[model samples]
Target: MKRQHSMPFGAEAVHGGGVRFRLWAPGVATITLQLDGDQELPMTAADGGWFELTVASAQAGSRYLFRLPDGLLVPDPVSRFNPDDIHGASEVVAPTAFDWSDGDWRGRPWHEAVIYELHLGSFTASGDFAGAIERLDYLVELGVTAIEIMPVADFPGRCNWGYDGVLPFAPDAAYGRPEDFKRLIDAAHQRGLMVLLDVVYNHFGPEGNYLHAYAPDFFNPRHATPWGAAINFDGEGSRVVRDFFVHNVLYWLEEFHLDGLRLDAIHAICDDSTPDIIEELAAAFKSVPGRARHVHMVLENERNQARYLTRDDFGRLLHGTAQWNDDIHHAFHVLATGESDGYYVDYAADPARLLGRCLTEGFAYQGEASTFAHGERRGEASAHLPPAAFINFLQNHDQIGNRAFGERLCHLASPLAMEAVTAVLLLAPQPPLLFMGEEFAAAQPFLFFCDFGPELAQAVTEGRRREFSRFARFADPAVRESIPDPNAPATFETCALDWSAIERAPHRAVLELHRQLLLLRHQWIVPRLAGMDNGDPRLAMPSARTLAITWRLGDGSLLALLANLGDDPVDATPPPGQLLFATANLDATTLARGRLPAWSVRWHLQPGDSR
Candidate 1:
C-alpha cells in the first residue's frame, strides 16, 4: 500500500515546463515516445518494465503515443485524454485549465444521500456532459442530492453502457472534451449537487484494450472474470496493476473534483488474498486530500458482504463501503409483479417473508443456501449492519435494461402497484436511488446497446440470446428477432429519454408524486435515520403485508410511512396523527376511517408524539 514517489507514468507537465513521458513495458528491447509535432525519442530504462523520458519543449494540447517493442504505436494505457478515439493517439490535457468555484462546498453526509443514477448518453439528446449540465438545477429541484453517473470512461464504440470502457483514465470521446466534463462538475457543485462516477475495475473491454501489449502481466491468466481475465491483484506484476488502479481512484477524486464513486460489480473482481483490492481501494480513497478524502465509496456486490458497508468506531467506511442491496429488488419484484422467473424464483417462494426480511435485515441471504446459486451458501452474517448500508432501488440500469425487452416497472405492474412499490423505495430508511426518467415515468426502454464490428456484433447478439434463453420469452425465435439488435443505432437512440413527456399528464402526475414523496423524505425521514441498523425493525408485518415505521426527527416530531403491499384492502387504524401524505387519492372519510386501498401507502406526522 506504499505510494510511489517517482514521476507518474502517463504524460505529465513538469513543474517548470515541458512534459515528462513514462510507460511500464517489461521485457521490451526498446521503447520510444513520439510527440505529435516532435521527433520520436527513445525512452530510458529504469526499473522492471519502467521507461521514462522528459521533453523540455513538449507543449500542452499535443497528442502522443508510445512505440512498443514490436514497433506498434499504442495509446498510453493511463491516458488522460483521447482526442481521436479509444484506438487513436492520446492528447495532453492541462488539468488546471478550468476555474472551479466550489471553494466552500463540503458536501452532505452519506446517510443523507438521495442518488439519481443516469447514463450521460441517454440522459439528454446531446448525450454529453455539457448537455447534462443544463439539467443540474432540475435535479436540485427534484430533491436528488447526488448524481451517480454511469461509466464515462473511453470505450471502443460511440454507443455503449460504458461497462466496456477500455481506457479507464480517459473520458469517452463521444462526450465533450475533458474541459467540458469539468464544467459540468463545476456547475453541479454550484447547483448543490454531488457527482458520483461509476467505475468498472473488474475487467477491461474486449476491444481497444492495449494493456497486454505494454504490460502482459496486467491481468491474471489463471483467474477468469465474467467479462474476461481477472485483474492481477495478487499474482506476479500485481504490484504495478494494483497501484495503477488505486492511483486511478485517487486521480478521479482529486483531478476530476468528483464527490464520490460507485464501483461496478466488485463481486466479479476475484481476489482471495487478505486486504482485498476493495479494502485497498477504500483505504486509498480515504487517504486522498481535499474533498476527495471524505468522499463516498459505494459498491455493487451480489454477495451482500455487509462487512464492507459497516462503519468503524468513528462512523467512517475508511476500509470498506456501502453495497447495493439486490435482495430488496429481488424480493420487491416478486412481491410487486409476481415475476418468479430467473433469479426472482428464490424470493417468489416466500415474498412476503423475504421482503419483510429485506426490510428488517440489511441482507436477506446472510449465509443462507441460495437456490439461485444451485444450493450454494452465499453472503455472510450482516444482521448487525445499518439500513443506510444497503441501497434499495426498484429500477436501476440493470434492473430495467437487463430484461428480455428492457421493460420498465411502469409497464409491468399496475399504476397502483408502481406507486405502492415506490413508497417502499422512497420511504425506507435505506438510501434510495432513482434511475433517470423513472421520476417522470418516461416511455424509453434502456435496452442493451453497443457498437462493434459485424462479426463481434453478431457474436454478441448470439451470446445475448444464449444468456436470455433461460427466460421463456427469449425461448422463441420470433421473440428473439424482436429483441432489438445491440449494435443497432436505433437501439441506443430509442433509450434516449423523451424529455417532452414531463410537461404532459400521467407523466406529470408521476413526477409530482416523486417530488411530494422526496419532499416528505427530506422533511421527515433522513434526519431520524441515525443509529438505525438491521434487526431494528420498528415495524414489520409479513402476514398482513403491512408496515409502520416511526422515527423522531430533530425537532421531536414523529414521522411514519404506513403501507399496504398486497392487493387486498384492509382497515389500517393508523395511530392518532396528522395525515401528511398519501399515495392514492383518498377521500376524507377514507382517511378518517384509516382505510388502506389495494396497494397503497401513506405518511403521517405527529407533532408532539415521541414514541
Candidate 2:
C-alpha cells in the first residue's frame, strides 16, 4: 500500500501521519534539506518559487534545516517546529486533534476582562508554557478572566523579551514545543479562561533572520525603523508580504485556537498602501469559520487615535479592538511615584489630567507639545467608543523593565501608594491589566534578556548602555553600576515567582487586596456600570481635582467610581445618594463630611431603593 500526499506547505490533516516540508527560493538554483544530525536530503523544485519534499520519516520531533546553494544550512526561515534551538526537536502539531471542552465558554466581554500580563521565560523557574498552566487556577480564583501572555514568537536563541521575534508563526522553542503551547491554551480554555498571545509584526529580531535573501523587497526602502527597514507593506510584491503575516495571524486563531493577539508597537508599522494591510487583515480574520468571533487585535501605540479603535469612514474598525492607554498609566505613575524622566517628563502630578483620563478617553496633552518628546503629541476624541476600547495598566513589562535599573513599582514606591492607584484602575470604566507578581507586590524586576549571536549580543549591550546615558542622573559610573546588569544570572533568577511569599503575612494581605478588589468589581461593578448611555456628566466638584462618574446599568442599579490623584482629601458630596462602599477609612458616622484619602480610589454603589 502507498500513501497519497497533498501540497507540501498547505497540506491538510488526513490520518495524522506525516508532514510534507516545502520552501520557495526562485532566485536560487538548487536547495537541500538538512535533516537531523547531518543528514542532507535533496529537494525537487516544482514551479513559481516553490520546492517540495515528502518523507514519511518526517514526523514529530524531526530536526531539519534548509541548505541553500550558497552552502548556508540555516534553520527553516518559516520553521513551524524547532526543538534544537532550545534543547530538542520541532514536532508537527495538528490543530484539529486537540479536544476542547470550552463549547460553553463565551469569553468574558471586553468590559469585564482584567488582564494579567506575564513573560513566559521569566515567569517561573522553568520558564515555559507548562509552568504557566500550573497557575491558571490561581488566576481564575483571583478574578482574572484573561491571561495576556507576552510575545512568544521565535527569537534568536533560548531567552528573550519577545518584542524582537523574527519567525512570526513559530513559538519560541525555549518556551516549549508548539504542541505544549496548544496544551496550555486547551487547559486555559477548559478553565473558562481566555488566552491572548502577544505578537510582533513591526520588525524582525537582530539575529537569526534570512527572509530578505529570498525577497529583498520584503522590506521597504521608503521607510526605516530603529531595528531595520520596515516590513514591505507598501513596497513591490507587498501582497505576498501581507499574505505572510495575514496567514500567520489566522494560523494562531484557527490553528492553535488562540483567543486574541496583542500586537507589539503598531505605530512603527508604516503602511501607505490602499486598502491598508491592517483593514485587509481584519477582514481576513472575520472570514475564519468557527474562530472569527473569538479573535481580537490589541495595539501598543503612543497615538491615542480614535479611528484605530473606531470604525473606518465606512464604519469599520481597522483591525484593532484596543490600544494601551499610555496617558492613563503615565499620569497615575507620575502622581504615585513622582519620578519624572525620559518619557515621564510630559507627565505631571495633576489630578485634572488623571480625572480627564477617567471621564474622557485621553489626556489633555494628547499631541499638545509634550515636554518629554519636545514635539506636539495628539489623540482623537470621539463618541464611537466602548469603555473597554482602552487597556489601562500602571506597570507592564515596558513600564518597569525599561527603567535604568530593573526596579518594579513596589521598589520605586510604597505599598499604600500602589494600593490607592489600584483602587482607581480596578474600579475605572476601562479594562485594567496587572503585571505578574504585581497583585502581591512582587519586588523582582523584569530585566531584559536575550540569546543572540556574539556580535548581536555586544551590540545589544552597548546599545543598552547608550540608551541609559540619555538620563543625566543615570549616566554617572556609580549610577550605572547601581543598575542591574541585564545579562546577569541574578536578573533572570530573581524574577521567578516566590510561591511561598504568597502564603506569608504582608504578602498575603497584598494578594488578598487584589483578589477582593477584583471580586467586588466582578460581583458589583461590572454588572452595574457597563454600557450606560445616559447623558450623565462625569462628576468633578470645583473644590476637588478628582472626578466622579455615575452610571445606571440595565438592572436599575447605579454605580460610581471616584478617581483621586491629589494630596489633599476630596470632600465630595455624593449628589444626595447613600454610600454603599467607601475607601476613605470613614464609616457611616463621617461619610458626609469626611474626605477621601490622598491619592486614593473609592467605589460606591447606590441602589434605586436606597435613600
Candidate 3:
C-alpha cells in the first residue's frame, strides 16, 4: 500500500505531471525558486505572503532551495529531505516512493505498551536506520511492544541527541534517507512492534533554522523559552505557524505510518490561546478516521498536568495517552542510590512514602509545594487517572544523558537493589520503559554529545561543563574541566551500545532477569490490565522501607505487591494470595512469620470471587 499525507505547503507532485512548490515567506516580498542550484525561476506572489511555482519538468529527486530578494539561499522550511545536512538544498521526495507492507497493522493498545527508547546513532554500530533494523528481532524477543526512537528530524551536524532538530518534516541524513526510516518503521510493524517517534514542537535548534529569515512571525518575542523566542502559537500570524506543526504530526503518522509520537519537553511550549497548540494537536490525532488503529500520544511535561491525560465518561482519551512520571523515577532513584543532591532533595526526606503514593495514586506530589521549585505548588491530583496514564521507568535518556558522567542505575545502585527495583517496575500495572542498553546493564555511558560548527561547539562544550559546576563534586574548576566535551567525537563514540557485552557474565544475568520479568508481566499482568481502575490500588507502609500494595485487576483478579527496599529486614505480613514471583532466597516461612528480607519483592495474585 502507498502511504502519503498531502500537505498544503512544500513541494507536492501534481496529478497529471510536474511538482508544485510553495513557500510561506511573509518576511520577504519576493522569493525565487532555485532548482538543482542553478535553474532559478521567479515564483508568483499569492495572498498571505505565499510564493508558488509549478515546474512541469521537476520530478522526484529534484534538489531545490529558495533565493531571498537579497540573494540569500535557504532550504524549504517544510523540507521532506535535506541530503547534504541542514545548510544544503532540500530534496523533493515522493512520499509514495515506499511500498508499505503493514497495511493491516492497526497498532497496539496503550495498556500493552512495553516501550524501549533508543537513539539511532548510539543504538547500533552503523548508527543508522538500517543498522537498527538488524536488531528488530532482539527487541521482539525482549517483549517490547513499542520502540520509541529519538528525534530523527534533520539537525545541523552529523551527531546529536536529536532535540536540536530544525526540520520537523525531514529525517536526518546522518541516520540514512527518509526511505530508510520508513523501512525501519515497516520492519518494526512487521515484527508486531509499534514505532513511536520523539517529536520536538517546543523550539528549533540553535542553528540552521531559516524561518526567521523568511517568516519572522513564526516566533513570539513576548514569550521566551530557554532556547530563544517561543513559537507563535497565540500571537499574530500564529494560524500558519500552528498549521505547520499540526501538519507535521499528520505527516509523520500518515506518510511514514508511525504508530505514535512522544512530544519532547512540552512544558517549554508557550501558548496562551484557547484550545492551545497541544489541545489542537490532540484533537487532530483523535479525529483520525480509523477506529481500530491505536495511535498513542505521550507527553513529557515537568508540570505534571493531569488534565492532559484526562478521559471522557466512556473512558475515551481526551488528550494524551500518558506522561513520563518523573516523580516515580526520582523517588526510586533516591531510594536505591541514596543520593540526595539536586532534585533528589524533594524525595530524600521520605522516599518510601512518596513511592507508596506513586504506586497507588499515580503521582507523589498532587498539588503540593515543591521544595526544589522554591516552594511553588506543583502537579494536579492524578489519583483519578488510570495507571496506564503514567509511564514509569528507572532510567531514560534525560535521566542518564543529563548526568555529568552519564551513569546508569547499574553504575550507582547495588546489583540486588537494581534487581529489586526492576521487578517492581516491570511487574507493576503501569507500562514501563527501558533505555537502550538497560536490559543487559551495558557499561557504556550515554553521554551528552553533539557536533556543531566550531564557534557554537566551543560555547556548548563550555556550557556543558559549567552546568555541573553547581554540584559539589565538580566545584573545582579543574574537576569541571575534566568533563567530556559534548562536541568531541570521543564523547559520541563512548555513548554507543556495546552489543557484545550481553554475552558476558553479569550482563547475561541482567538480561535474563529482564526477560523473565517481562515474560511474567505478559503472562500474569497484561491480560488483567484492560479494565483496571485508577483508584483501585490500596497502599500501606508496613515498615519504614516496606510497602504493601494491592490492586483490583481488570479481569476480577487481585494483584498484590509486598516489597522491602531497605538494607535491613522489616516486619511485614504478606497479602493472602498465590505467590507469583519473589526475590532470591525468599521463603514462605519468613513471610508467614512477618519478616521480609532486605531488597526483596514479592508479587501475588488472588482469584476473583466467583458469584
Candidate 4:
C-alpha cells in the first residue's frame, strides 16, 4: 500500500503531471522559486503572505530553493528532504513512491509497550536508518514492543542529539534519505515492533533556522525559552505557526506510518491559548480515522501535568497516552548511586519512601514543593492516573548523556543493585524504557556530542563544560577543562554502541538479566495490566530501605513487590502471594523468615477472585 500525507505547504506531486510548491514567507513581500540552480520562476503572491508556483516539468528528485526579495536564497521551511544538509537546496520527495508491506499491522496496545530508546546515529556502526533496520530481530528477541528513536529531523552539521533539528518535515541526510527511514519503520512493523519518533516541538536548533528571516511571526518575543524566543502558539500569526507543527505531526505519522511520537521537553513549549497547542495536537491525532491502530502520544513534561494523561469513562485515552516519569528515575538513581547532587537532593533524604510512592502513585512529587526548584511547587496529583500513564526507566538519553562523564547505571551501581532495579523497572505494571546499550551494559558512554560551525562549535563546547562547574567534582577550572568537547569527532564516535560487548562475559550476564526480567513481565504482568484501575496502591515501608507495594491488577489478581534497596538486610513481612521472580537468588524460605536481603527484589502474584 502507498502512504502519503498531503499538507498545504511544501512541494506536493500533482496527479496530472507537475509539482506544486508553496511557502509561507510572511516576513518577505516577494519570493522567487529557484529550481536546479538554473531555472528561476517567479511565484504568484497569494493572500496571507503565501507564495505558490506550479511547474509541470518539476518532479520528484528536483532540487529547489526560494529566493527572497533580496539576493539571498533559503531552503524550503517544510522541506521533505534536504540531501545536502540544512543550508542546501530542498529535494522534492514523492511520499507515495515507497510501497509498504505491513498493511495489517494495526500496532500493539500501550500496556504491551517495552520501549527501547536509541539514537539513530549512535545505534550501530552505520549510524543510519538502514543500519538500524538490521537490528530489528535483536530488539524483538530482547522483547521490546516499541523502538523510540531519537529525532531524525534535519539539523545542522553531521551529528547531533537531534534536539537541534530545524526542519521538522525532513529526515536528516546524515541518517539516510526519507525513504530509508520508511524502510526502517516498515521493517520494524514486519517484526512486530512499533516505531516511535522523538519529535521536538519546543524550540528550533541554535543555527540554520531560516524561519526568522522569512517568517518572523513564527516565534513570540513576549516569552523566551532556554534556546531563544518561544514558538508563536498564542501570539499574532500563531494560527499558521500552530498549523505548521500540527501538519508536521500528521506528516510523520501518516506518511511514514509511524506507531507513535514522543514529544521532547514539552515544558519549554510556551502556549497560553485556550486548549493549547498540545491539546489541539492530541485532539487532531485522536480524530484521525483509525480505530484499530494504537498510535500513542507520549510526552517529556517536567511539569508532570496529569490532566493531559486523563482517560474516558471506558478507559480510553482522552489526550496523551503516557509521560516519562522522572520522579521514579530520580528515586531509583539516588537509591542505587547515593549521589545526592543536583535534583537527586529531592530524593536523597528518603529515597526508599519516594520510590514506594512512585510505585503506588504515578508521581512522587504530586503537588509538593521542590527543594531543587527553590521552593517552587512542581507536578500535579497523579494518583488518579493508571500505572500505564507513567513510563518508568532506570536510564534514558538525558539522564546518561547529560552527565559530565555520561556514566550508565552499570558504571556507578553494583551489579546486584542494577539487577534489583532492573527487575523493579521491567516487571512493574508501568511500561519500561531501556537506553540503547543498557540491556548489555555496554561500557561506552553516551556523551553529549554535536557538530556545529567553527564559531558556534567553540561556544557550545565551552558552555557544555561550564554547565558542570556548579558541581563540587568539577569545581576546579582544570577539572572542568578535561570534559570532552562536544564538537569533537571523537566525542561523537565514542558514543556508538559496541555491539560485540553483548557476547562477552559480564555484559552477557547483564543482558541475560534484562532478557529474563522482560520475559517474566510479558508472561506474568502484561496479561493483568489491561483494565488496571487508576488510584493509589497499597504501599508500606517496613524498614529504612525496604518497601512493600501491592497493586490490584485488572484481572482482580494482586501483584506485590518487596524490595530492599540497601547495603544491609532488613526485617520485613513479605506480601502474601506466590513468588514470580527475585534477585540475588532470593527464595520463599528466606522471605518467609521475614528478612529481606540487601539489593534484592521479589515479585509476587495472587490469583484473582472467582466472583
Which order, best to worst by lDDT?
A: 3, 4, 1, 2
- How far out, in Å, is residue 287 in model 4? 2.2
Worst 10 residues of 4 by lDDT: 283-292
Model 2: lDDT equals 0.70
Q: Tell me how candidate 1 scores on lDDT.
A: 0.81
TM-score of 4: 0.99
**How many residue pairs clash (N, CA or C atoms closer than 3 angstroms) in each of the candidate models, in the order given?**
0, 10, 0, 0
* Per-residue lDDT of candidate 2, residues 505-591 (tens digit): 778988888888898888877776455433143555435456667655535566676655666766765544444455535456546
Top model number, lDDT? 3
Off by over 4 Å in 2: 1-18, 37-48, 86-99, 291-293, 311-318, 349-351, 362-367, 533-544, 552-557, 575-580, 607-611
Q: What is the C-alpha RMSD of each candidate to the true structure, in Å?
A: 2.9, 3.7, 1.2, 1.2
Return the TM-score for each candidate structure: 0.95, 0.90, 0.99, 0.99
| Whole-model lDDT, model 3 | 0.92
Instruction: For candidate 1, give the lDDT of residue 180.
Output: 83
Name every residue pair that clashes in candidate 3.
none
How many clashing pairs in candidate 2? 10
Candidate 3, poorest ten consecutive residues by summed lDDT: 283-292
